[model samples]
Target: MTRIGIVSRQQESDLARIPHVVRLVEDAGGTVVAESELRTADVVLVLGGDGTILRAAEGVRGTDIPVIGVNFGHVGFLAEADPESLADVVARLVVRDFTVETRMTLAVRVTQPDGSVETGWALNELALEKVERARMVDLTIGVDDHPISSYSCDALVVSTPTGSTAYAFSAGGPVVWPNVEAILIVPIAAHALFARPLVVGPDSTITVVMNEMGFVDGELWCDGRRRLAAPVGSHIEITHAEEPVHLARLWTSPFSGRLVAKFKLPVRSWRHQERP
Candidate 1:
């Protein structure tokens, strides 16, 4: 029998739906397990929005545990299935009838000026944003030991292709498909002309140095969930993680289809005339 691990959004309404979801999985001859018992499970079912799925990803990092997400919140871009398809989702889980797709992740390391260091990972994008709004954070960015440019900016969004459509996109970065193996760098509200969205190879290491003379410090946000203080003269580095996030999918649609569906992009052309 297959074991299904469950992780929910934890909202009152989302929690209420778990009973029905568990019942469906049980009826399909699957056993439900806690997120902590993932070692014994074949797959994990996340019942929430993208944020919940990202949280689950963090737990299963460095493991090949495939996570299947059911959308229960607004703009569930990371969710592979909808809440209405709970029965199908359960059936697929019991039979192990799904494809596991790997998405690239970023391993982030922060070295404070005081010689302290911290390391973390992000499933989406890891952002470095201003801690104080009074002044912009001064940053000097580079790639693979080669200097690129330096300037003051509101934030610097370092993202994987899986994250390009997220904060990177909102920051005027290009929407790179998830399959593309690259690290995307986008400077947010940069005060310099040389700062622009950049795409580097997956093996590249991105480095950012916070200028010591800056008026305020910056904060390092991992998927907008985890945080670390980035003081002046701090050095931050990002690279493709060794372990990628695994996502189980029942749908065979291409990334363009997913993008169109998620953004609700109109495909109808001017040639399609409405009957008068």
Candidate 2:
């Protein structure tokens, strides 16, 4: 019997549906196990939406256990299967029938004046943002320990290609395909002349220095879950992590297809317009 682990949104949005999911797995000849015993689990089923998937990403971060998402939220971009396909998904999960796609992750380190180092990791992004509204935080951006520029901005989002579709995209960053290995830095509402989003090589390291003289201190959030404080003169370092998040892909469709379907993008070409 395959040992299966299940993770759900903390909001417990679909509490009523969990038992049904369990029954499906049970009927499919799989045993539901606790995430604490993740080492023994063959694969993990993540329930809920993209946010829930992000929350579950941390649990198996440095492990080989792959995650398969079931769409139970508004936008289920990260999910491989929908509620209507639950029975089929459960049957597949029983036999571990899926391909694992490796997605790059990021590791963040926060250095305080007291010489204390705090670390976090995320599958989406490492965001350094002002704690208060209507206030911009001052930050000095750099690559490989070399300073690039200083600016007062609402936030600085450092994301992997896999994250380009999440917060980074909403903040005016380009949507990079998940298979692309790169880093994107988008300065949110920046007050600088050259505030365009930057794409960096996968091996490059990024540093963000927060200005203590600014009106508000900043907070560092890893995938919107783990958090660390960034006070004045705090230095934050970001780099591609050794560990990658594995996603169990049921369909071999191109990522572009998922993008168009999820966003309901208009595909009508102007060249195909009927001439009057």
Best by TM-score: 1
TM-score of 2: 0.94
Question: lDDT by residue for model 2 over 8-65, one digit each (tens)?
Answer: 7666557667788889999999998766776578888888898888867777778898
* Model 2 collision count: 1
Error of 1 at 104 (Å): 1.0
Cα deviation in Å at residue 149, candidate 1?
Answer: 0.7
lDDT of each: 0.91, 0.88
lDDT score, candidate 2: 0.88
TM-scores, all candidates, are 0.95, 0.94
Model 2 — which ten-residue stretch has the worst lDDT?
9-18
